[model samples]
Target chain A: MPTRILKKSWFIKSIFFTSAFIILLIGGITYRNIDDLSKSSELLTQTYRLNVELEQIFSHLKDAETGQRGFLITNDPLYLEPYDAGRENINYSFAELKELSRNNPTLQKNLKDLNVLIDERMDYFQKAFRFSAVGNYNDQNFKENFYKGKKLMDTIRLKIKGMIKSQNDLLKKTQHTYESNLKVTPIFLYMVLLFSLVLMFFAYNKIIRDLKEIKASNEQLEIFKESANQSQIISQHGNWIWDIDTNTFKYSDNLYRLLGEEPQSFESTVENFMKFVHPEDAEKLSREIEKMITNKDLPFVYYRIIQKNGTIRHFKGYGKLHESSDGGKKLLGTITDITDEIDNLRILEDRNLELERNNRELSAFNYVASHDLQEPLRKIQTFLSRLEDKESSKLSEVGLTYIDRIKNASTRMRLLIDDLLQFSRTNRADNVFEVSDINELLESAKQDLAEIISEEDAIINSDKFPKINVIPFQIQQLFLNLISNSLKYKSKDRIPEIHITYSKIKASDDPEILKPKKPYYHKIIFTDNGIGFDNEYAEKIFVLFNRLHNKDEYSGTGIGLSICKKIIENHQGFIFANGKPLVGATFTVYLPIT
Target chain B: MQEDYINIILADDDEDDRLFFTDAFDELRITTNVKTFNDGVYLMDYLNNEESIFPNVLFLDLNMPRKSGLECLKEIKQTDKFKDMAIAIYSTSASEEDIEKTFVMGANIYIKKPNDFKTLKKVLSEVVTINWQYHTNGLNKDNFLLRL
Candidate 1:
């Protein structure tokens, strides 16, 4: 793209150079034409002057001849005066002709020959005049002399006419040459002017085109700068530049606004900007700025600033060195306001501390429930048993009944405590999950209820299970609780038949799994042929201490199913219960197949 | 001392528990000599004496005033004289933590104190009859707790 621009600029430059050269050429041609016209006109003027000198010489010779003829006809001495004056005038004209024809060889030679003919004509006139003074009117010598003078005068006039014709011919030749030059010069100069004008027009068009392009790009740059300023305000950031060579700073207009002042309200210098810095952070910020100047770079620096309205804000800054093509060094920097983030972090830290305290207190409560509360209760039961064994015979029937009632109450209390402890243990954070054999865990659970299984004649069928990742002890307890729940609510007429089935299924296959966190789950379904309740209580059954059956009807602490739910949730799995009155209950547990 | 009868010792802080232990032993038909201490300190003081007779089975109650059953077990297991003696951890609340700790410290078995007098007598007799050499050979975490 830049290369294309460079090529275009080169084209414009060549056009500019071509236009200037054409203009200079026009100026040189016009100057040379003017100089040639002036030289040609000067030659024409010299030729006109030379022709005038030649005509004057001929007129003077005619005057001298006319005077000599009058003297010969009337013997007037006044005529002699005219002849002498004419001779002097002719000599002066001859000198002027010689001076005018000095540079022209052909004209000088013609003038010299004309001078010789004039001199011969004058000699004949003198001879004729001398003969007339001696009164020899009838003498043949005088008559011959006069005739010869006339002939000599004719030759001189002819020579003068020849020189005049030749001089006129030379003048005509000079005029023709000057007229021809004048004729072609206007056309040539007009064509050269027109060509230069065309070159100038092209240069003007290119300049206008380039200026339009520059205007378009400049407008785009202006729009970009405006948007950048708006973005800086929105994002709570500002930009700056520090010229390292001159140690001068340039802050963008938005940078001034970031300091809680109008744009460009203050000079952009370190001292001027430092006035806004929080006193506590000023020293640190100064040290960082100093380092940035020396290193020609700025690492991330955090500081605080108090605005004019007394609102304190946290700022983080970073800079990078920019070296322009002309070898100017500058640091381009950006600073952001991060007060909101720091405040959020502080709130999160406080909340975390409170949560930790609450957790410690909860564990303390668990310890009390496990050890302290059970100690006294165990002693009471032991003493009660002693009473039943040793003093039963002495007591009345009512008193013995009271003893039995007390025993039942204590046993129920112990059951409640033990179940509650089991529930809380499931909530422990440190339970380790391992790859354990599900079959082994199931067998162990059944072994825990071995005597009941035999006495109730419960027929428990199971499917072979693969190794699964789970909390071994907790999963065993889950199996134990579920099986016991079935036995406790067994139908009286038919023996309890518990069917345990296992399969690996996709979470999408189960409609009950809403918003599943995992794709596949280990589905273990425990379907028991027991006295089931209405399906309406399926969800309520898992609630802590929630029971569908009364204590008199079923010996449940209502904590068993709740513990199952908790265990499933700990593994990010799901548990569901479905039941129909007297048909049976199906408890489905889904563990994530990790 | 009679060589044919078994020697048993129990250390518990509760007076009523001590009375129950003696009464159950008195009712049983097994020919045994029983000794009792109120707390671990008195029990340790008597066992540490060189002249005192060591019991074949030592039952240690976990909760006590000066020292606990776990601490006493640690001390007894470290002594060479008590290497062959069977140590049983007997506590009211048989928490998994206590059972695990006592097992690691070389206790032979763990028993939660039974709530009824008959169950207590039954557990004591069963424990007395157990062949320590055979039980120790097959001891594991699963059977470490003496289930009812």
Candidate 2:
């Protein structure tokens, strides 16, 4: 879309510049032609004036010679008066023509030749007049002198006339040029003026069209600005533009709202805007902006603003750069309200804290429920066992039978209670994990059940156990429970053989395993040659109260495997049971080694 | 379980508990001499008294009227005179905290009192036999750590 606008702009701009160039070129050519035509017309007019003056000078010289001949031969002053005036007019006209033609060396040289002929004619007229008056008054001498003077005057008149005629020919040609000019000037002027007017009209029309476009754009800009303001109000985000050259800032009211301020609440300088930013976030935001601006790139900053109401509102400021004529920078862009985003983050944090607290409570509850609930059950078993121990000696046959039954019932009840605890604690995060040496922790747990372990003739062996982060007490309890359970479920005909081994298991990268992923897990596999279950019940055995054999078959708490499952799960891992009915069970526990 | 100077102390926070315990002792016909105190504070005072009798067994209740059983045990265990006393932790609550804390504090045994009166009636029947001190009869002062 923007490319389309650029293409349109390029097309219009080229048209405008091309038309302007064409009009200017044509106007220049017409103007140059008009100047040359006007200069030539003025020169033609001057040449005509010079020709008329030369003709008058030639007539005056002839008149002055006639007056001198008449006065010297007939002695009349009347004819001399007209000649003297004519002579004066000739002298005045000659001086004026000479001064006018002084810069034209060609015209000056021709005029000088005519002037010498006139002077010779005048001297001849004076000599003829003196010879006719005193030396030879005879008709022959008179005729001779008169004729020589007339011949000299005729020669001077002819020379003057020749100059006048040549000037007249030039005048006729110049006048023709003048007439042609007179015809051409108006037509040329009108064509050029009309063409110029037409061009100007087109130019003006184009300018008007451009003005209209600009006006429409301005109107659209106004509407855009208005909508922008409205949008800022609705969304609490304002946009701004800072012209680098003008050093002016413009922004919508939403910008002020984000700052927890009013338009007039603070000074409208960049420094003033930065002042409202939280001090801690300000440095970070400014640093980002500085890095971007110094490199003449756009900058993005997110920070909090302390509003007038003492609430911290988050804002994300973005800046675009514009360089002034002198290469100074101006940051122009928008500041958006990110208070909701910040609030969401805070809520998430609070929820995580709540989850952690709930987890801790659950762990404590699990431990308490197991320890507390087991106490009564243990006491019941101890009493029942004691009663059974003395059944033969202290009780009648019926009483003996009843005591034995009660002992079995109590032992079964103990197993049920343990199963119930496992079932309840399974869904809870009730395990506290810590980095511990598995060997030492296991030894301590074994010490706790020393009497039973030693009496069972059980051989406990293991590889170098991993020192992993896990719940020490829970893991120890798990070992004791499983070992004791294996001993209790030992095949009546076969001696129980237990093997405790540790191996590395591959970790999963399931989407549910968020955050840092542990790529590997250390597993503790406990294989016992005892009364195992069908492979179909492998998963079921880990469930609460999932027992295959009845009370008569084997004495066992169905929750033993379940407890192991729970403990392993608490350590961010899993447990699975693999066994065959009446064979042995292999309980593999996977614990993440941190 | 013995008549030759086998002495035991029974400390309880409740008067009724002491009375009931004394009745049990009488019914058992235990030859061992018994001493009872209502609170750990008085028990501590008695132990510190010039004419105090050192007992082979000490049954200590956690919640007492004055000075808790744990504090009394701490005070007694710090000294060589009462350090060898076979202290059994008795409490109504069988909480993991109580059990762990007692064990961590070097308690010899942790006992939870039965809630039902029927169980309590049968519980005290063979109490003397499992009193722990009797089991370690051959353990002298120096070999006490190896007995339990």
Candidate 3:
């Protein structure tokens, strides 16, 4: 391409050469102008000098001729004084003319001739002065001397004219040469100046064209920079440029705003940026960044940050870091604010939890409706059976016996329904809790079970029970159920005896399904001398409707232990039964110490 | 000669509770004769009598009555003449706050009606055997006499 440009520029080159030639011409013309000025000055000087020399010669000659004529006219020796003075002066002038005529060989020769002529003339004038001094004015001597002087004067005049003509020729030649040179130099200077102007115009146009292209490129870059910044803001993205050599970082305005900062307000350094990150997530972010940096794999980092307002926000930073061969390793990245995305996820999680809670409540409500509703339904069934018996006729004994069984089954179903209702309403009891004396609570509970206590002939004994924080009515129900459970399950051979003992026991600190997560608990024990179930069934004894004895042997709804479990759980504690089958049962309840 | 000890009427709906109360009264052996009724409606029906015996003591169960014990107590207190009758409220609940409110309603004593025979005896002796103010038409200014 460069060769193509060079080849294509031949026309331009011709123009350039033309312009160059013109410039050379102008330079030469300018130099020649100065040369002409010097030459003209020299010419004028020569003319003036020659003129001056000619004037000196002519004046001296005139003085000499006049003096000679005076001497000739006066014929007195005193008049001869002018003649002698003219001779001395003409000699000095003759030498100057010779020196002035050196540049012209012809003038020099003429000057030599004039000098000889003046010498001859001077001699003739002297001879005439001698004649005037010797003869008294005799006609022959006077005529002879006068004629000699005139002839000498005429010859000297001719010589002076010849010298003047020679000098005039030299002056005319010098003037002609100077005028011709003056005419040609101006034309040459004008052509040179025209060419110089053309060359300057071409060079100036080239500079301006290059500058225009450069300016256009700069404008395009400005537009590109502006759009890039706007897009970054809209996308919640920020970019960073680190000058590895300077150990400095520069971040975009979006990064500042993501951390709840104004455009001009935040520091975007990596150190300061780490400060905004959540401490728990910082290590993870850093580790990921480090791994990416070390491996040059350029992995993306998504982590949580705490904004200036103390809200947990999520941020994602993605970019590649490369080693700048220019001398520093720099890491460049883009950050995105993901707070809204994280908040939406949290809301989804909360909604799922709410859904689960609602599902549990709905199922519990259904269980209560089906289990507790049986009592009234069974009563209605029994009444219906009794009414059917009143209308019965022509039935076999077997059929009658089946109807009686149905009535008995309905009666038992009625009792089961009542116990189920009690179980469901346990949490709804409006028992105001206070610092109830456990001693008083136990005594009252024991007294309330009067029929059972007497019928079973259970010898009840007690010890000082620890005061605890509990709902008194609920606890009373708890005691009544447990005491009844013991008496109902009494052994046929063993005497029924119930023992209640209490101490500030440090309960097992482990948390159970319904137990409060506390450090310690108060253990209360109620031991009974009744048929205790096997240890394998100890955990199952607390389930609703879980019974070891048949209804014929021990009359109970089997819901007593379940109620006790609910109350114990409500008190933020737990209860468990421990015993062997046909031996005895020991139920211990743990209550929170606080 | 002693105004034939005041007749105090006791009413309850529960049969076992009534048995427990009667046995307790027998065991305590209080001189004041007590009458019993099945419900507060029956007791109120008797109280409305114009020519009937005015009982000296009335032991009412709160849980009884189609009108409730509070309503009966309100009726008794509103009638100025019967206000002097020593009324005791018997209940299975031992809430102290309930006893406080009953006293504020002009009850003479609040007794926890026991479910156990032994507890009933103790509660009966404590209520019927305790010295109580006997109302007369013109008693002395300092004291209304009570037989301890």
Candidate 4:
């Protein structure tokens, strides 16, 4: 862009110079032509003057010859007086002709020859007059002298006429040359003027075009600066420039606003701006400014500033060295108000600490539940067992029934404690996920319920399974809880048959997986022929300690299915129970593919 | 007959658990000489005595008032005198952490305290009848926990 401007300026300069040169050429040509015209007129006047002088000389000779004739014929002295006066007049004319023809060599030569002829003629006239004065008109010598004198007069007349012709020819030649020069000079000057006018027109057009472009660009710059100001306000930042050469500063209007002041409210100087800096940060910022001045650059520097209203804000500043085309150095800088960001970071840190404390307390509770709570419950059950084993025969029937009830209650308490511990363990975040075989985990769960399976003669059938990513032990527990749930709720009339099936399914394909977190899931369905509860209790059964049947009919602590739900939740999966009264219960689990 | 009987020691903080341990052993048909300590401190003091006879099997309860069973197990495992004696972790709660820690610490087996007298007697007799040399040779993480 600079180069383009440079080229444009160069073109304007060339046009200006060429137009000036052409004007000068026209001026010179006009001056020379005027001078030539004056010279021609002067030549004409000189030639005319020379011709008149020659004619006067010739006429004077004629007067002298005529005077001699009259004096010889009539013997009058008056004619001789006329002859002397004419001679004096002739000499004056010769002097005038000599001055006029001085610059013309040919005219001077002709004038010289004419002078000699006039002299000879004047001498002959005088000799004749002398004879005539002595009354020698009748004498033969006087008569011969008179004829010779007449011939001399005639020759003199021819010489004067020849001089006049030559003068006229010289005047004509000069007039012709002057006329040709005058004719061509006006056309040449007019053409030059026209060319210069065209050149000026183009230059004017280019200047107009360049001015328009500059105006458009200036308007664009204005818009950009306005937008920059708005953006600075929006983004909580400001800009500044320090000219190193001039030791001066220019702060954008937003910079003043950033300092919580009206634009240009104060002088843009280091001291003036420093007055707003927080006392705690002034010294460090002054040092940084000093370094920036010396180095003409600044890295990120953090500081605090107190506004006029006494509000303190955190600020971060950075600058870079910018060298202008004129080789002047400046530091272009930007400062941002980061008070809100800092406060947010501090708030996040506090929240994180609080969360950590809560987690620690939860883990402590898990430990108490697993160890301390179970210990006493185990002793109670043990002592009750000891009582039954050692003294069952001696107890009355009523006392024995009480003992049995106490035993049932203690056993339920143990179950509840163990189940609560399992639920909390599943809540722990330390479980590591690994790729595990679903069939293997199912087999392990079935083995855990092996005794019950054999005693009840229950048959378990399952489809082939694929490996999936899961918390291994938690998934195994999930399988154990669900299968055992089905087994415990089996119909008294029918043998228990549990069918475990596995398949890959899209989350969208399963209506049960509402608000699916993943696209694909590993679907494992446990279908069993059991004494299923009403469908209304499907969701309720998973609630902790929520049981559909009384303790006399079902031995569930209402915790096993809750533990299963927790385990599935820990894996970020979903478990759904579907049941019908006395037909079957289907527990479908969908684990995310990832 | 005294030499032929199996020698056993149990360290538990609970008096009732100590009574249960001795009672289960008394009821079992296996001929055994059983000893019980109220806590790991008493059990360690007896085992550390130069004149005291090292039992064939030592049952260590994890939680105690002072000097927990884990501390005693670590001390006994380090001593050459107790290297040949089998150690069983007998705890009311069979948490995975305790099971893993005791297994790693060279306990021969981990038995969660059963809530019934019958299962307790069964577990004690089975532990007593185990061939120590054969069991130690085949000991692994899967078999470390006495599940039944």
| Candidate order, TM-score descending | 4, 1, 2, 3
- How far residue A490's Cα lies from its native spot in candidate 1, in Å, is 3.5
Interface RMSD (Cα, Å) for model 3? 12.9
> Best candidate per DockQ, number?
4
Winning candidate number (TM-score): 4
TM-score for each prediction?
Answer: 0.75, 0.61, 0.36, 0.82
Kindly list the per-residue Cα lDDT of model 3 for residues A111-138, writing each as its tens digit: 7776777677667666766776675457
TM-score of chain A of 4: 0.78
Which residue pairs in model 2 clash with each other?
A363-A430
Error of 1 at A218 (Å): 8.0
* Candidate 2: regions farther than 4 A off: A1-39, A59-117, A135-394, A411-432, A439-465, A483-519, A523-531, A582-584, B1-6, B13-32, B38-57, B63-68, B74-96, B99-148
Report the poorest 10 consecutive residues by lDDT, candidate 2 chain A: A508-517
* TM-score of candidate 3 versus the correct structure, residues matched by position: 0.36
Model 1, span A457-525: residue lDDT tens: 999999999999999999999999999999999999899999999999998988888888889999999
> Considering only chain A, what is the TM-score of each predicted structure?
0.71, 0.58, 0.42, 0.78
TM-score of chain B of 3: 0.77
Provide the interface RMSD of candidate 4 in angstroms, 1 decimal place.
0.9
Q: What DockQ does predicted model 4 obtain? A: 0.78
Q: Which stretches of candidate 4 lie over 4 Å from their true place?
A: A1-19, A61-95, A101-235, A247-297, A304-312, A437-439, A449-468, A485-594, B1-5
lDDT of 3 by residue, B28-135 (tens): 666666678888778878888886677777887777747677778888899877877778787654334566667677777766543234555566676665566643
lDDT by residue (tens digit), candidate 2, A1-594? 333444456545765676677667767766866775685666666676787788788778767866776776577777677568776887788797897676678678887887777667666666666775575766676677667777876776677667667666765776677667667766766776676667667767766766677778879888988897788888778777665556666765677777766755665656777788888888887777567546645566778878767788888878778676568767668888978877899999999999989887876687567656665665556556545554568778988778778767766775676566555554434456578888987788778778877777777777788688877877787887778877877877776788999877566643323332478778788899887878898788777667778868776667777777777767777677788777888887777767
Could you tell which candidate, 1 or 3, scores higher by DockQ?
Answer: 1
Chain B TM-score of predicted candidate 4 relative to the true chain B: 0.96
| lDDT against the true structure, each candidate | 0.87, 0.71, 0.71, 0.87
